[model samples]
Target: MMNINEHLLRTFEARPGEFLSGEELSATLQVSRTAIWKHIERLRQEGYEFEAVSRKGYRLVAKPDKLDVEAVLGRLHTRVLGRSIHYMNEVDSTNNVARELVQQGAQEGTLVVAEQQLAGRGRLGRKWHSPKGKGLWMTLILKPRIPLHFTPQLTLLVAVALCRSLRQITSLPIGIKWPNDLLIDGKKISGILLESSAEEENLNYVVAGVGIGVNLLPDDYPDDELRAKATSLAIEAGHTMDRSEILVAFLQELESLYDIYHEQGFGPIKLLWEALSVSLNRPVTCQTPKGLAEGTSLGIDESGALIVKLQDGTVTKWYSGDIQFSS
Candidate 1:
């Protein structure tokens, strides 16, 4: 059964630029006129603009610039991704919360989201700036029945889904760096961090932490260093976008691609990812835990490791590293 708010939204969407009278809504929703009025008032408080006349009732003129569980679910059309949501006004990290929930037997497609992350972190323990309600700071808990080694491919899968989703919203040239850093105009715009646990050969759960800078401006950065390296969707598009719509599109694309990954394999996803890659066939160096290796990137192998052909006619695969490009 649909909720009253969702019903109201559908009614407004079904008949755009047309007034819905109180008697009509009351009869259609099987509720009192007072109930309809209350729901409309709540939507208005959430930044919905309504044109209310004496007897002409309400008409939706605008929507909120926010992304919450309700907003995402309102527009979501997916099978697995984003089926369950844990929304927070503020939290330390969505990934931490997602891991905790998965340990408690949370189902796949469970999403942990926050308006602000006090302890948000990217790969290599780098701090990720998550201001209040300025970006999509969320983590998805997935339980793919694959080996621990194959789990790295999910990061690449997420990069492809993210790139496709962002392309749907803006005309910016979005590309992926090795391992899954989303870049636009050669500047970082998003990052994906995957954490997982396994017992022997059996696989456990994987928490995918995703952070996308949406509505932030260059001045929002704390210092010039970050401003020079980071850019947001709003900064590139010259307008603020609806985070809810973007999240819904991302979930839909992710679900479709994830199903394809399970049925067919990683070949298709790898092709798509490589097509959007920026580091492939480029001169780069990986700073690993042992040391640094400089070579020309040969894209990725089957297991999603960074493949680099060194100058001395040797090839190496880097599982985890800080990649630096030396054009």
Candidate 2:
């Protein structure tokens, strides 16, 4: 069945900046003019701006700065990733929901998104700040057939995808801080967390949790610690941007990158990740499960491990850890 709202949107999108007459839309959608008017009002409440004429029709003046499932889907053009979407007003965490869905046999490309995450978490169990209608809190479920040990490389792939998408949408000097936290002008603007369930050497499922500070204001991070380290696109761009558009762009980029990784391997992904890394050749201290390894960052190795040249001229590889840099 044709969706009434999507049908109406397609008409406006097909013309873009031109008006779609009420009579034409009614006939095409097989609905009454009154029903069309109600749908327009519903979209208006969701942040879309429509210019209605007495006898002419309605025009899509602007889209809202919020994340709407239909809005994101309309802009998405991906073979995989974001084929199915689960949107919520609030949740404990999109990652948690994605995990549950995967257990219930959710397929790859399934997505879970929430406007706010009450128990949002980051790497090393850090609490992510997710207030209502402020940021992008979502997770992607992937059922990659790659070896279980290579799953961490997906984090780098996600970072590269996000970097490409953000670069196209805004003019901010975004850089990938080693691993997958995105930084704009030295402050963290986004982060990626990876979780997977696997057997000894085989693969199962992977969940890539992504939290982005989009259209957020200074007051959004009330905590002094977060206020000093975090920033939003709206705060840096001097204005708010449409979160839905950015989400669609990200999914498209991710889909492309994921295809590349599966077919061409991690060589291409590592090159792009290294080119955009801010930690290379910089002094750093990584706190791994073993202990602290302080050294100069030598970039990542083929297996996606951080190569650090310690002070004693010994080089060590870190697969999982928290990276701390010196000023």
Candidate 1 to truth, TM: 0.80
How far residue 327's Cα lies from its native spot in candidate 1, in Å, is 1.5
Which residue pairs collide, candidate 2?
A: none
Report the lDDT tens digits of candidate 2 across residue range 276-309: 8887898999877767778998989877889999
* Candidate 1 residue-wise lDDT, 231-254, digit = tens: 999999999988888889899999
Look at candidate 1 and give me any clashing residue pairs: none
Winner by lDDT: 1
Where does candidate 2 stray beyond 4 Å? Answer: 1-65, 289-291
lDDT of 1 at 117: 94
